[model samples]
Target: MPETNLPASKTSFVKGFDKWNIAVASGFYNQKIDYMIEEKKQELDEKNRKYIYKMLTFSLLIAFILFAISLYVSTYLEKYFLKYRKKIYKEVEKNKKKDILLAHQSKMVAMGEMMENIAHQWRQPLSIITTCASGMQLNKQLGLLT
Candidate 1:
């Protein structure tokens, strides 16, 4: 074997040192990549949280607005219903008075009709009585009866 300027053991140590340096650099690079990935994930989580918060706030605001509108509409409708009910009550009272008047008028008409019928029924009996009295007086004058 020919002898080189560098010893064989020293050359082997140099080669092994180079390999260890490469492995350390690779490990550092891998750690940096993992840190970057973790930072990106945190940023995404923060953005999602902000989006969810905005959505929840908007939903609550819309719900409050709808509730206020419904309350106003319901109050307005309730007042309108009360006014209408009062008007209906007045109309019902007027109808009741009219019904009573109509009933009184019906009774008056029925009484008038009954009085007329009674007068008609008595007229024939009164005429027969008058005729019988006159006949008795004439028989007495002619001595046909004691």
Candidate 2:
């Protein structure tokens, strides 16, 4: 028989004993060893199944916790972003109003400069007309315009 198929013996061998004599005296059987091996394999399989179930349950619980945390963080960030965006919008509106006010002031300044330029342009012509009218009045008084 091959070494792997040899039966396990409960009895220990005596020193200097003949191997064939011990085999007969020990009364060990192959069928009993095979039965014990099969029972041990089933016991180990059961233990492995219980360990796998525990690991699966623990993994699912951790996954659920992580999912909840992600949801909370995403919601918090969304609200914060909205608040920041509103603040920025208000700032932009305020700057737009300031720009409009500055544009109006600039237009008023330009209009005042235009009115000054128009008055300067008319001054010389009005002075010339006044001098000619005064000379005509003086000539009429002297009777030089028959």
The prediction achieving the highest TM-score against the true structure is: 1
Error at 122, model 2, angstroms: 2.3
Highest-scoring model, lDDT: 2
TM-score (C-alpha) between model 1 and the true structure: 0.67
lDDT (C-alpha) at residue 105 in model 2: 96
Error (Å) of candidate 1 at residue 119 is: 1.7
Give the Cα lDDT of each candidate. 0.82, 0.84
| Regions of candidate 2 where Cα sits further than 4 Å from its true position | 1-28, 127-146
lDDT of model 2 at residue 27?
Answer: 37
* Residue pairs in collision within model 1: none
